[model samples]
Target: METNLLFLWGTPRSMSTAFLRMMLERGDHEVFHEPFSSIVVQGRTVVGDHTVTSHDKLLRLLEERARDHRVFVKETTEYDYLSTGGDRIPYAGRHTFIIRNPRSVIPSHYAMNPAMACEEIGYGNQVEMARRVLAATGERPFVLEAEDLLDDAEETVARYCRHVGIPFLPSALSWQPGDQKVWSRTSQWHRDAARSSSFTRSEATYEATVDSDRFLYDCYWHHRPYYHVLRKWARTTVAA
Candidate 1:
């Protein structure tokens, strides 16, 4: 059997943790969550079970993990910190990009971290990483939209499974509500997701208030163009 290493990359508030939970329920792949966040935010050397800080070591660890079992790693594009204007990690495997509209992502992200920078929002990094993955693998990475995934969880997830060469199991559509073993208690976003038994459409009203907050409004514009570039390629029902 061929061991697989799948990377699900996204920006904050893109429903990434929730997707990670779904993947965890598959019960076949070894799942990792936010292994690179600490390195990007704190300049730390260790994240989760992987202690090596350098990009080369991290890639080697991933390869080692996948030697016997399929590995699923859900991380954010903020790990662009590992890159110096080139491919951050040299390992080649399935890459999936999860994205949310800036209009939705910005307000929720701002609420979580009021001092968030445009760079930390990660839209540009997501795009850059996707391009690098394409150039390296000569394959277009699967692109998913959080809204679409919520709109039709089964269909969207089925499409995702087919795209990534995983078996489409209905059981992955939902999981027991609460934090998975992989998440840290420090992430408020993951905590909120852990509270859900299933994917729920975000009812948080940001549209009405986004323009009122001058700083947030500007940040939204900063991420808008980058969001559109990926949104055009996002996998939706129409594509399915």
Candidate 2:
């Protein structure tokens, strides 16, 4: 009867990784670690861009690992380019968009992947991405903020549970952002893997940044037509 799946879409620096740990720390045997990661998703089987076998094939593998217990799916990705390549499968599941103020996100993503420009991404545009989703994409994910996930953990988690059709597991509230109980070192892909406050929700809003009023911040990831794709991502991430 455990028929729920969770697909979280957002940029690299958002709290989706923390959210991943939250899902794993639970006692459900059906809920496995990230089945879509680079390791498990490809492994010896070797799945690539246009040649993805199918999520059903992946689900079968998890079911094999879990014996016969019910299995749940969990994955996190950016809003704009998710449907491309083999990521279309996650879009078929119950989904949510984890939004954080891009000010906090730019710094956090820089911390995790320091090769990008720092001025373009922010929470405001993450919201704009969500609105574009209704107009273009075939997906609709509930929107919830990283700040709320931290400040109002209980309510935020309950809302996520409600969206995914899972019973609210109180234990998910205390789930640490990077606990080993939920993941091995290989599972995490963030900078300083053990600890980094750059992803915090406290100062995530535009108000937190000095460039709030600027016409343009950074222009690497948020450029022209593709920029609208980010809005599409936000629309899918926004929770109903």
| Candidate 2 per-residue lDDT over residues 1-240, each given as its tens digit | 133444565555666766665665665634543444543335423222233244556544544444444345444443222332343443233445776655556545554444544333434334444454443445554666677777777777887777667778886555334435334534455423235322234333333222542333443335334434554544454533
Identify the candidate with maximal TM-score. Answer: 1
Candidate 1, 160-196: lDDT as tens digits: 8887888999977777887666876345677668887
- List residue ranges in candidate 2 displaced over 4 A: 29-72, 78-91, 117-139, 175-216, 220-240
- Could you tell me which 10 consecutive residues in candidate 1 have the lowest summed lDDT? 82-91
TM-scores of all predicted structures: 0.89, 0.59
Candidate 1: stretches off by over 4 Å: 1-3, 42-50, 82-91, 206-208, 235-240
Q: Estimate candidate 1's alpha-carbon lDDT, on a 0 to 1 scale.
A: 0.76
**Each candidate: how many clashes?**
0, 15
